[model samples]
Target: MSINPTESCLDCGTPLELTIAGQKKKPCPKCGAYRRKREYQ
Candidate 1:
């Protein structure tokens, strides 16, 4: 299954974008990191 690099967050509905690391990141740069962390755990 392929992923959309420009999609929104499934949980918070925040728009997403590609990061320098090639990961889909949240629209809110600050909350993005926290959200990803919470998602993994």
Candidate 2:
């Protein structure tokens, strides 16, 4: 099987890397430090 190409971080907009483990919802690495999305506003 192959991972879907649509997988990505909603915050930083980075392409999410995948493995045999599984897909999980994780904070964006580029914006992981900031918990709030509205912080930039």
Candidate 3:
């Protein structure tokens, strides 16, 4: 399959590396860390 283009992270504006994983609603590292921090608060 062709490598698909990645989308931007909604929270952090980082380019989501979805090229390898395909279209998944995964957050970027910074957003993930921020979300985790918020969840524990």
TM-score for candidate 2: 0.34
Could you give candidate 3's per-residue lDDT for residues 5-36 as a string of tens digits?
A: 54565566665444343544445676572221
Residue 24 in candidate 3, Cα distance off native in Å: 6.3
Please give each candidate's TM-score.
0.30, 0.34, 0.38
Superposed by TM-score, candidate 2 places the C-alpha of residue 29 at a distance from the truth, in angstroms, of 2.1
Candidate 2 residues 1-41, lDDT tens each? 65444445555656544323464545667766323222111
The CA lDDT at 41 in model 3 is: 11
Show where candidate 1 strays beyond 4 Å.
Answer: 1-5, 18-41
Top-scoring candidate (TM-score): 3
lDDT of 1 by residue, 1-41 (tens): 65435544555656555355765443554354334312211
Clashing pairs in 3: none
Candidate 2 stretches greater than 4 Å from native: 1-5, 19-26, 33-41
lDDT values, one for every candidate? 0.46, 0.46, 0.46
Better model by TM-score, 1 or 3? Answer: 3
Rank by TM-score (best first): 3, 2, 1
